[model samples]
Structures are given as C-alpha cells and as structure tokens.
Target: MTAFLSRNLAARASMLASLIFLTACAALPRSGPNKPEIYDGAVERGGDAQVIFVNDHVTRASNFTPAYGFSNSFRNASAVGADEIRAGDVLGLSIWENVDDGLLTSLGASSSQLQQIQVDSGGYIFVPYAGRVRAAGSTPDQLRQVITTRLSEQTPDPQVTVTRVAGDGATVSVLGKVVGQGVYPIERPTRSLSAMLAKAGGVAIEPEIAVVTVKRGNSTGKVWLTDLYAGASNDIALRPGDIILVEEDQRSFTALGALGGQTRVPLGNEMISAIEAIAMVGGLNSNLADPTGVFVLRDEPEAVASKVLGKPVYGSQRMAYVLDLTRPNGLFLARDFYIRDGDTVYVTEAPMAQWRKRIGAVVGTIGSVNSVQNLAN
Candidate 1:
C-alpha cells in the first residue's frame, strides 16, 4: 500500500508539472522573436513591413546605392583667375614721375605711395589724376595701365603699379571638421575646392569618411574628400561668397537582435556591403542567433521598390530583406549586397534557444514540486 501510494503521488506530481509547463510556455524569456514569428508578422494582411529574400536577382534589381559626388555644374565649372579683382578690395598704388615735383608728389620726392586704397561699391577707385578708374573688374596690371594713361596726359611718363593688399570680396568661409576654420582668400594656389581645403589645413576627419560640401548662392554640391583626387573633374573651381563645409560622414545603420553588439554603426568607407555591416556590429551571436534568419529592414524608394518587387509601388515602401547564411551562395550574396543608411540589420533568435529556456523553466518547476512533497512526508 505504501509503494502504490508513492507511485500515485509521483504520477500526480508529473501531471501537475506538465500542466504548469503548458500554461507558462508563452511566458518564457527570449531575446527576440524566432524566424517563424518574423515571417508570420511579415505575411499578415496590411503588414507593417514586407520580407524579401536576398539573392543575386534581388540585389541586382534593387539599385538604390547612394554616394557623394559633384554634379555637372561643379564638374564643368572652369577655374577663375586668382588675381581677379572685385569690389571691397584694398589696393596699394605706387606712382613715380620723371619730374621731381610730379603730380601729387612733394618737391623732394619723385615717387608717391598710396596705401590702403579701397575699391568702392561701384567698382571704382579714385587716383590723384586718374579720376575714379574702375578697379574692381580689372586685374592689378590692367588697373596699372588705366592709371598710367590717365596721369600721363597731365604728367609726362607717369609710372604706376597696383598691388592687392587685402579684400573680403573674393573669399570663402571654411567651416566644420577641418584643421583650420576661417575666411580664406582664393589665390592662385587655392582657387579649386581641393586646394582650398588644403589651405584650411586639410580635413580633420578621416579621409575615407570625410564629406566636402560647397554652397554657392542657390546651388550646392557635395563629394567625398577622397574623390577629390579620384578624378580631376571632382576638383571643382572655388567661387567667391562660397561656403565650404568638411564634415564626417553622417550615414549609419542600426544593428539589433542576436548580434555581438546592438548599436548604430557608421559607414567607414564610401560603400559597405551587408557582410561588412554585420561584421561592424561584431557578427551574429553564435549560440543564440539563427544563421538562416538575418534580415535587413529599410524603407525602399518607389522606383527601387517597384524594381525589387517587379510591381508598381507608390511612395516609399517598407522592406525587409532576408539573408540565409546557411545557403550555398548565402555568404556571397551578402558580400555583394549593399547596405543603405537608416537600415536595420536584425537577426532572429534560434528556435533551440527558446526550447532551452522552456526546458530550464520546466526543470525548475518539477524540482520545486519534489521539495514540497518531501516536506509533507
């Protein structure tokens, strides 16, 4: 009777444990949803996001790679002369006459020096006898000719020389991520975008991730700092009243789920592949991550979405691209796949991981029941 009672109590305990396990199955701890759950969420009617498998075909169809490069306006622009004069410029004029008592010269001096002769807003400068010669549009040598001619009518063989002292007329403001930040004059050595950056003591950020922007009036252009030497066309001419900004690349993507790290990763190169992005976050969590359920989520532009789905899509569509690393060409596909800014790279939890949690929970419950029965005995 004792043995039979013991058997009955054991069976009752087993039954109770099974009931508790079933009731608490949904409450098990998990890092994130498993593969099946993600699929179900994607396929539901009016789903929040669509899931598409990553393959060579899909990679080729989705052509939404964004990069920084100058437009035609910047590429086609011609370099301006460094010595070109403009209004608001300060000039230094020297005048010498053959006669000792020359026009506007003292009895003992044969040459006269005019320091800091500022060009007026009307692009003209007043000379003793030249009478408001237009200096803003003329180069130093050109202005010299005009002044010499005007003075020669009154004074025989007047020698004139014009020198640019300083000016705010033809200057560019360099700001952001540069060794030096200030208003720089566009001279012969610093007339182009690349040259002007050097004048500002080069970019302070890494060249691989530096972005250079030039704004002139209503137009603006941008390009990677490394591309400045990639081609001559990218070395655009600098214009007066231009604003040049050198900054670190602002493009980044977020990594979530079962990965070594969960954070936003910045682009370290001009272009980065999906594999590179995964590595940036320390790859997948080997013990808990589902190798077959990696996903890249992004909002696809209308044109790219239409091509990717082979159907017309209106506006920006939410897309989730799946990558199965277990497939034969999975790693290769990932290597070629490109990651865009504002993308979410997620890896689902392995199914076995959840099962392990459930097993642990059931084992703990059964141990508790055994302890209670022993106390009652």
Candidate 2:
C-alpha cells in the first residue's frame, strides 16, 4: 500500500507539471501561423490600420518629403550674403602727414594722435579736423579714403589708416555641439557656413549625423550637413550676429523581431531606402526570419495614407508595410522604397521557427520532469 501510494503521488505531480507547461505555451504572444497576413486581409478588414505593400508602384510614390527645406521659417543665410560693418563699430584711426612741422603737424602728434573712436548712432566718426564723417555702412578701406580726403584739406600730403578695433555688430556666434565656441568676426562681405564650421573645428559628431542650423535674428534655417555639402542646397552665407549650431541628427529607426540584433538605425544620409536600412542592421536573421513577411512599420501622414488606402484614413496614423522578397521585382522595389525616421522595420519568423520553438519548449519541459523524478527517487 505504501509503494502504491508513492507511485500515485509521483504520477499526479507529473500531470500537474505538464498542465503548467501547456498553460505557459498558450499564454505566449503568438502561435500557429508564424507570419500574420498584414498586407492583404489584416489591413483591408481594418479597424484604423493602414497597410502598404511595397512594390514597383509603391516605390515610385511621391509620398516622402524632405525633412529640411527652404520654407518660410528657413531662409538661407547664404542668400543674404556676408556681414557688413554697422553703427556701434569701434574704429582705430591714425593720420600721418609727411611735411615740416606746420599748423596741423607736430613732431610727435602723428604717432600720439592715433584715436580709438566708436561709430556713433548716426554712423559717423569724429576726427580733430575731419569732424563727424559718416562711417556707418562703410568698409574700413572706404572710411580710410574718406578720412584721407578730409585731412588732406589742412595737412600737406596727409595719409590715413582705419582698422576695426571691435566689431560687436559684425560678428557671428558659433554655438552648440562644435569643437570651439566663441564669437567669430565676419571679416568678409560674403562668408560661407562651411567656412565658419571649419573655423569652429568642425562638429563633435560625424558630418553625416550633424544638423547645421543658422539663426538670423527672427529668421531661422536648418539643414543636414550632408545635404548642404552634397549640393542639395546652397552653402548659406553667414550674417553678422547670426548663430550657427551643429547638433546631432537625432533621427533614427528601430529594427526589431527577427533581425540579426535589434538596433537603432541612424538616418545618416539624405535619404535611406528600405533595403539600405535592412543592411544597416546586418540584414534579417537567416535562421529565424521570414523572407516574404518583412515589414516596415511607419506612421503614415493623413495625406500619404489616403493615396495608399484609396480613401482617407482619419483616426490613426499607424501603418504596416509588407515586402514580398520572393518576387524577382520585389528586390528592385526594396531598393527604391525610402525609409523615414522613426519607422520600425520588423521581419517575422519563418513558420519552421515556431515549430522549432515549440519542440525546444517541449524538450525543456520533459527534461525538467525527469530531473524532478530523479530528485523524488
């Protein structure tokens, strides 16, 4: 009776363990069909879900928009050209007269009388004889000529020189994630944004992942540094008091599910196609991935969704995209289909992967039971 009771108890414990394992398997996220039919049926019998099948037609769609453009908010500073001297500029002025000591000339007066003068609100500078000449809106060379003409009236063979001692109004500030941070004087009439970036020791981040911004008073413009260099847009000329910022791109997409490893794929180029993005994450996992069930998940804009859905998808921006790589033409479409930032690229597992998973789980459960039986003995 004691031996019979012990066997009955062991049998009950094994049954209980089997029941627990089955329960756990049923509670898993997905089972049966490894890849859900998101393209044809799941999207069409939709409850606010948008689906796009990436193909030759979809690849040629003009739904993608550039992140940065020459919009009203973004006026290219290069179009405005270089920094010029304005009122409040401090000028270092010196006058020389080559002659015998006359009424206006003294032995030491030429060297001693080099005056540091600020351009007044009226844009004028004062000399001992020249008296309040308009210096505002004039270059140092232009002002020198004006001073020379005025001083020539009283002194014999008068020569004059003008240098900008302080140019607070005619300077650009290089800020944000750059190697150097300081106020750079805009000495030229036209200076490129690239020139300022070079002076600032380039950006801390790689050029591909750097976004260069130009802030001119109330107006501002931003562009990818890669775009700027690739001739997508003009190399904006900097203005006095403009703020140039080099910031991280901060745009990325996620690779999930059956990829080699889940990763955040940085949008390092002007545009990255779906195939390029997959390659960036080391392509999909060979053993586990479903070649026909590759999906690019994105939040479609209302307007873009309308084009794909044949009707307006108003409530939700969610979209699931399927790429059937089994077709010969599918590879071409993948190369052409642009991938936007914040997209989720997911490759569902092969049907065999699920079967393998179930087999592994069963084996593990059986192993656990045998170990328990050993412990009981």
lDDT of each: 0.85, 0.73
Candidate 2 residue spans exceeding 4 A from truth? 29-46, 62-84, 96-112, 120-134, 140-161, 230-233, 312-316, 373-377
Can you give the TM-score per candidate against the true fold? 0.90, 0.80
lDDT, candidate 2, 178-293, per-residue tens: 99988886655336778778888888888777888888787777888877877735476666678888898778899887877787877875678878888888887888888888
Instruction: Single out the weakest 10-residue window by summed lDDT for candidate 2.
Output: 75-84
lDDT of 1 by residue, 264-302 (tens): 998755577888888988999987899898998899999
Whose TM-score is greatest here?
1
CA shift of 361, model 2, Å: 2.1
